[model samples]
Target: MRKTLLTAVRDARSGLALRLIAILSIAILPLGLISSYQTSKVLEKNGALSEIALLDRTRQAAAEERALIQSAFGAVEAISAAASIFDSADIDCDAVLSRLITMEPKYIFAGFVDTRGIMTCASNKERANLSETPFFQDQFANPGGLVSVRPMDATTGGIALNVSVPVVVNDDLIGRFWISIPLTLANDLLGESSDTANLLIFDSEGEILATENFGDDRRTILPQDRSLQEIVRGQQRTFRTHNRRGDLRDFAVVSIVDDTVYVLGSWEPRNTGALTGPSERISLYFPVLMWIVGMAVAYIGTNRLVIRHIKRLRQWMRLYSVGQIDFSQARLQSAPEELEAVADAFRAMAQRLSEQERRREEDIEEKTTLLREVHHRVKNNLQLISSIMNILIRNTDSEEAKHLLRRVQDRVMALSAIHRYVYMSPKLSMVRADQLLEDIIRQLVVVGSADEPENKVSMSTRFDPVELSPDQSVPLMLLATEAAINAVKYCAAANGGKPWITLTLQDLGEDHVKLSVENSRSGLAEEQDSDTDHTGTGLGSRLIESFVSQLDGTLEINALPDRFELHVSFVLVKDEGDDAL
Candidate 1:
């Protein structure tokens, strides 16, 4: 019972049941905490919503202010056009001013000022003066040039827009036309659905011109700092500054008429509320409750279902490891989910292993067949070379012909030597080229010098040990055989004595091999360039060139008074019969 319980605990630790419990706890805990936080801050969230809504209302109010300014400027442009006609007309200044004053109620008054800075015509008779007014003084300040617009009061002592244009003819100053329009129509632009918003317009002189409400605190805002007043004078469209109410407010201005910039500003405090603690508490509880229920379900499943099935499956797989295949009684049966599929997978795996064993046997048989065929072909090729050498021997009787046939026979024997080594060993294709060369030289001593010791040539070898594939080994063996025959025949005849032939193989760096043959012979230069018939002109030189060309090697023949040497060097590729291939 104790072992069973321990196994159950181990299964539970590795199983998904405990993992699901952990995931539920992690996923639901943070959500519960966030919901609880929101519940506690419900009132704060509402206040935040209100503040954001007010900021949007402020932006809308600024847009309306710009539209109102655009409309008022249109009216001013129209009035300026009408006043231009008076310069050529035969009319009194007083009559012209009267007609302009009655043209629109939005215009509080209209008049004209002369070159002497005197108001020549009056729409408001009481304040009508030829001089002494700021408007009259500002009008003639530019004299005969473009007149400046001023922000001032209407005749009713309310904020107003003031405009003036110089009456010029042929670049000569005549007088200035002036008009003042009431700013009451501009208040229509300031009205907003949000309660705490207000719009105001200030001029360059730090004076309020048109404002929705001129409370003492807001009116004094321009006097406290030059920033707001500068915004009015310049053409900047959007600005933000602190109002006298100590609230950070955004302001935007638009030109209603020339020189009169209308500004709209609204305030918002940063700490407007969003959510209450109580509302967040309830939101947090739902996810926490779900986590508890999920954990309970997982704990029940760990003990009742997952542990039981997994322990049985583990024992069955352990038995399957030792080649026990009776799974029908020990087979896993569990909930019809991933566990049942895993049991079926185990059965299928066992059957696949059995099928692979049979395939392995068949592969061994096929490889055996291929190895035998390779050996057979190698034997046939060696026999063919032997037959060709014999045929050439029968067709010729000259001492040179006999020597050539003997060299061909030796090369055939060299190939046969490699074939015997491969056939004797277990390996199918490769024979070490060094071992093959040593054996061929040993055999050549017996056959080429069996009759006479006076005609004997001492053979010696020097080479770095290297392996060659059969394809390379065949051509190389033929070249060596030819070089050996040349050393024996030529050097023996000329020296009037037994001579020595040395075979040396050198490895030239990573991808090349060199074969060197040198013989001790006097008058060696005369022999190589001799006009002799079969010995110099026949198959030996051609065979040497063919082997060198086939192996992509360079052959250098050096003849001295006493020594004759031949060197062949070529690229070495990996042997074709390498085991990896």
Candidate 2:
């Protein structure tokens, strides 16, 4: 029971059951968070709807203010239409203003100002000269256009908008009609907000025309926000609030009334009554926290259960990339069923590779054995041929015929020497080139000088060790032996009588070789052989040329005053029998 418990714990540490637990926790997180998530989304949507409704309210108020301005302009146009209003000399200006103010109670002042900056006809009983006021002085330069001015009130110490229209009759400019109203007229339109939100109105001239019911201590604000500026430029249609600079939760829009721009908005405080206490905020965010924790655990558990083992298996295979493969020594431990199957496949593959290598080694040994037997058979047959030639040479009585027979015997023995070396060496593919040459010259020197030791020719050789294929070495050895035999035969007539022959085998780098044979020769030797039926070289010359061609070599023959030299050079490619071809 204790072993079972330990195994269970190990499995749970990095196995499917732990992964399943992580997955279950992940699945439960969304269920826990759905209510809080929906509540947040609903609150966001309601906030947007409230902002839109507040914008609509400001738009309606602006439309009403536009209508009020048009009414005020119509009142001035109505009085300007009468011919008697321009005849200011006989007019009762105060009586006229009283009648006009009674007609539309919104307009408190109605009078005419002359070019001299004095009121010519009065609308009020307490009318002054009015030349000091900048509001009426601006009318003389622009005779018939409407203008607005903000003049401070004596009693309230606040400013009001004074609108004036130019008064002209029958191409005669008498003065201008003027009307003044307090900023309280704007507050009549914007009543009150439903919540803690406040309303404000401003013109592009940096004047806060009207604001919420700010008591004596209420702080009024001007909407100079970037969003409000964008609205004034007509680039942005509407805007929301941001507290990046200050706590300004004022969602506002812009309205253009008679070339005057107005910003109308509502203000919301930073920490509202909706989301107040710490516990309430925690309840809103707890689900999201649980979701993050659950997903993290699930990812770690799944990586341990499946991904980690896969990575370990990849590491095992990567070892083979560096030419190392040993399945037994690097055996994979127990794993999930699928991974165990992969490990089993790797072991089976390793077994097959070992078997293939063993069979390949056996094949190489068998081929080598067959090759050695071939060379041994060739050597014996050539030796039998050489013995028959020797027997034939002894039976012949003619000296010329015996000389020719000995030459044939020398060629046969050169062939036998190459096969002898191949069969003797452990490797059957190639024979040692230096030993093959030495053996060829050894047999030639012994047989050629055996009967004539009195005129014995000295033989000297230089050799460089190189390996040649059995086929190529046979041709090469024959070519060298033929040149050596010719030198031994020509030595008797050489002028110095110190008759000598030399063979030099040299290696030129990049797998090339040079073979040279030189013997002392004289004009007397040609005269001695001139009476003979065959000149010194008839058949041997042809045989030497054939071997040179077979080896893809170049041969040069030079017969100087007292010497004969034959030089042959050929390329030698190791481990390949097809170098020439």
Candidate 3:
């Protein structure tokens, strides 16, 4: 599997489609990069806008709370100014406070606490010790207008906003005048907002005074790693963080009453525009998608418009190279003009080559037939000459002259045998050296043995297959004939042994061959000495030497008492046609 994948990758790297894809990718790279960068900028801008919008919503939600606090401060100041009137005799402080509460329905309790923490001029009949309470003590120490949240107000008996003001008449400081506003009334005043956001109003101490739209799972909506005090300390107008439940949320903090109260609004991050939410993710991947799409288009276009036709042309050329002469232009018909022209050029070249090959083959056949006829006529003419010599030899009365004529006739027959084999063989240029040598040796032995029928000469021939061009075969055969004839002429039984002649053709490997002709020596010492003299004529020796020179062979002769051996070794000559192939 790994090898298959590697092969596929290697093929892809070499293919035209990959090259085209690379070019297209380079061309589109800048545009893709620019698109991605612009998308990122858009996302950043949308994020800033989202933060601003959240802060605006938080400030808007705290508007009612701001108004209620302002009204409480106004009421406390009005009651403090009226403290001098309460100092006169015959004034009903409780009645005055009750009527005041009746006029302002948002105020649940309105009263004045003296320096000793004695409740007087109260709106309700319930009495509460003022001095021991934290709000009263704080007011006593500070002696200024204050707004405080009470979890369980001593006067109202519920969560309420304690707005207090210092009570003083002229230069004399008396006590504190305070109003209790129920949290339920404050929530009613604030009302509900349109957006699905959780609103929280907390004081400077991080104590949550009022909440709107908060669920029972309040911890889930709040920041997991931070407290309200940390958020107030940071004083960040807007921020983004994951809530306790691991849900991402955007938060906005706005001051409702300058360092005293702050409102925090949290909601799920909103999609400001196109580059937000799911669209933001798409924007981030847009560049990669662009590159992939471009490469795919390029690959498809290149495969269809170019590579397919080129491969078809390649296949056609391969077929033509392997001798498939049939040609067709239809396959490239759908190709572009450039590719079609290339196919046309190749087709024309193939046609010319095919025509030339056909003509050359015809010429070779005609020449081969003419050459074979020439060799056949030459063989017949040489036979006729030998027959004429036979008639001359029979007519002659001198024994020496007849012997010479017969020798000449024997040489003529050897030449005739070479031409006969040439025309009879399938290949005109090359002949099998072993077969030609065997035939020549056998014929020579037969002629020599016939001269003395009583001398029983056993001739054995061994030929190994070897091929040579006609030029080499002719000389090789002539040399073998001369050597075999000499061997046969002197062959005799040694010491009551039967006379024998052995002719051998051996392939010595590496384009070399050896021919051997050996015959048993005559038993008589005088006859063996005469055998070394080559039939008392130097003509046979000269002829053998000339034939050996023509064959470019090295000749060796060994005359032992038992036998005479002649061996020739030569490099086989290869045909020109075989070399070309």
Candidate 4:
């Protein structure tokens, strides 16, 4: 993955699309920055307004809760002012309290507690003493109107709000007139707007009084770092924090009753009603969308306007380099002006090169035809000379003169054969040496056999394909002719065998070749001495040496008891035009 990423980055640096994207991005950078700044400011302003709105909603919910509590307080105060309920024992306090409870369904229990913390009058028959309860003791010590949350009331046997007012007869506190209001009443009041917010009511002592729209997993949504008391300290204020579930929420704290009760409203920050859904999305994504659109346009435009044409030109150049000069100008006609000019230049160069190549081929053909004709004439002239020598040999009577004439005739025929092979070859500059040597050796064998027809000398020849220039082919042909003539002249059968001559041409690797001519020796001692005496003239040896020198070759001669062998090895020099062909 790392290597692939590095390679991608390197390619991107050199790619036209990426460069265009970078250029477009830089051109729009200031506009993007400005858009981002404006978005931040808009969001910040909306956020401030959202906080204020939350605080206001919290205050409204708190007011509703306070009104419910004050109503309970007012009922208790009104009942305490009824002197007949506290002062006149005959007024049937239980009946009046029970009647008050019946008239107000919010109150579950309404009664009066005397100074000794005894339930002297009661709405229900079941009664108990509250003197030992902390709320009763605090109320008795303070002796004023008070409101508190009761988790469980002894009279009602359920969660309720205890609203109390001191019962005074003639400025002497007789007992406390208290009413038990069900906590459900506060919940019902706050639940009306619970869909928009989660509400929780807390007393001065931080005791929860009621909750609205809270689920059983309330702990997850509630503040984790602070208690209700700490939060309520910031009265009429709003703040942000992450709930126990790690969700960021906005919270507002507002007083329901002065130093007595408070209500907290919490909701997710994303739920802020400052902007519509589409508006918010547009604000957040506008800059990024703009950048993407700009980059896309740049990439497409560059690929079409420049890259595609350049690629076409590059392909054409590649084909032209390999001699595929044929082209269509239709594609180039649509390219930009500068690229079209380049295409025109390349087309002109290819045409000129093609014309030059055609002319060169024509000149080579003309020269080769002329050269072949010259070789043909030379071969015919040499053959004519050999024919004339034959006529002289037939007409002369001197045996020595005929012998010399035949020798000269043999050399002339060898030269004629070399010219014949050169002109017959496909290439004027190179001749197949193996074929020329084969022809020359056959002619020499025929000539040598004719001198002594009774002997009927046996001959064997082997030739491997070898090519050479005329300069080397001529000397090589002459050398092989001389060797074959000597071999046939002195050949003798051994052990009752017929005289035989072997001619072999081999291609040694690395541009070198070897030619060998070997002939058997006679078993008779006198014939061997006679052969040694004839070789003393040194004419054939001298001719072989001179030919070898011309061919830039090495000569090897083996004169054994049974056979005589001559071998010539030389490098095959190739013509310069061979490579061009």
TM-score on alpha carbons, each prediction = 0.39, 0.43, 0.53, 0.50
lDDT of 1 by residue, 301-420 (tens): 775667677767778778878867656544555555787888778777767875775687587657756766676677778878888877887787786887657766887777677676
Please provide, for model 2 over 368-486, each residue's C-alpha lDDT reduced to its tens digit, 9 standing for 90 to 100.
67767887899899999989988888899998898888888888888888888987976666678888888888878887787476767788999999888776787898888877877
TM-score of candidate 4 on Cα atoms, chains taken together: 0.50
Please give the RMSD to the true structure for each candidate, in Å: 17.0, 13.5, 11.8, 11.2
- Candidate 1 segments exceeding 4 Å error: 1-402, 492-498, 507-511, 528-537, 574-581
Worst 10 residues of 3 by lDDT: 528-537
Residues 1-581 of candidate 4 have per-residue lDDT tens digits of 99999998998798888887888899999999999888878877886787678878777766777787878888888888884545565678888889989988888988777888788888885567888877678678756677766544668787677888888887898888788888777777878755767778776667667776434675565676777777766543677777777877778877766667777787766556352346666776789999998888888888787888877888888887887866645366367898888877877877888788889889888878887899899999999999999999999999889878988888989999989888898877788877888778888888888987887888998899888898888888888877777777788887788889998989989998998988898645344333333244467777788898998888777777778778888888877775475
Give the per-residue lDDT of model 3 (tens digit) for 425-507. Answer: 88887787777777777777777777778887998888998877878877777777767776777788887899999988888
Q: Native-vs-model 1 lDDT? A: 0.63
Ranking by TM-score: 3, 4, 2, 1
Query: Least lDDT summed over 10 consecutive residues: which range in candidate 4?
Result: 525-534
